[model samples]
Target: MEMVVLENEPEVLMENISNKDNRDTSAAPGLKLYRCVAVSFGLLCILQIALNISLRPPLNHTNCISNSEDMTTNLTEERDELKRKLDDLKSHQNVLKSERDELKRTLNDFAHRSNNGWLYFSHSFYYISPIKKTWHDSRNDCLQREADLVIINSKEEQEFIQRWVKNLMWIGLSKRDGIWKWVDGTRLTQSLWCAGEPNNHKDSGEECGEIRGCGHDHGWNDEKCSNSNFWICEKKMAL
Candidate 1:
């Protein structure tokens, strides 16, 4: 009976082993398929990470380049605008200067026309009166006109004045305290007195100076302040 039981045990064990192998064989394909799917998913994740890494630098570089180009364009546009404004300002300044010059010319023309009988000579304005007056009255009239009696500073000036005078004319020279002086309180340095004149007649004292005749070396004469004569007025030009 023992020999028979042992034999039956071997047969049962063999059958159990064969059943396990059959079950393993049946499940192998499904297990391998699951493993392959997992491995493929891992490989796809790695590839996506690598692709993102590779494209990141180019994208960043492109953005940086675009920003730099935009900044440069903005700066260029601003510079052009500033330059245009500067040009406009310069043009406006030129126009203002031209208008100012035109206004000055108009004023000068008006002055020349309004102030008749005033002639420009040697950087001075001169006026010769057609009527006669005493030396004092003539000086007062010159003062009223913002001028003074002509003060001959040079031989050329004396000659220039003579060309405009037809008769005796009271000048700016006068005898004060027995000393010859100009209207501006300057002592006489040179004189053009006529020969044998300025005797200061005892009866009619000659205290004022006069330009006697034209085209003569000595054309000046001393006369009484009360005497009437045409006079010349002088006004210097503005500096």
Candidate 2:
């Protein structure tokens, strides 16, 4: 319990205060550098967020346009494929129709050959009977054969008949109600009569028309219906 001097105590307190001040001043620069680094990092994060927001809408829009284009291209390709299929189907249908027509013609020709001795000429089938028959009976025979007596419409037809006939043949020409007509009810416009034919003989009444065989000029004549003669039949083709 000895009493200390006041002057020494004062000097010791001042030295301690000066040392604390020096320590505070030395730590201040490090604390300021740390605060500056933290502020720069926060600003960089905000800038990155703004950049992402600005680019997002354009990217989404580009993706939508690309999808739409792809869909349109797919639809166009599908439509073209369908059109090609339709065209192919139509072409095939036409070919089948042509084949069917050709088959029909062949069948008709075969049927004619099988039915009788038929000669094809000018889209018609002709049948010449070997035996002689009366003019009326000859017409009946043609009707039974699904035909009619030959009617010469053209000069080629008349010449062809004359060349093929070996004997007098009954034709479709006849006199009905005093007017010369064909079996089809057509009035006769031209004739290949043998100069003085169709006299309408008063004694025998030559009412039927006939064609004479080859070796004769203008091989046509009028004869009585009761007279016997070879006959010709004609039938049109199916098509």
Best by TM-score: 2
Summed backbone clashes in each candidate are 0, 0
TM-score of each: 0.53, 0.60
What TM value does model 2 have?
0.60
In candidate 1, how many Å is residue 118 off?
1.4
User: Candidate 1 lDDT, tens digit per residue, 1-239?
Assistant: 45544658878999999999999999999999999999999999999999999877555778899999999999999999999999999999999999899878766854873479787778788889899999999999999887899888999898788778857989998999999898899998888888867779775889999988635453888999999998989987642
User: Residue 232 error for model 2, in Å?
Assistant: 0.6
RMSD of 2: 7.5
Error of 1 at 75 (Å): 28
Q: What pairs collide in candidate 2?
A: none
C-alpha-based local distance difference test score of model 1: 0.86
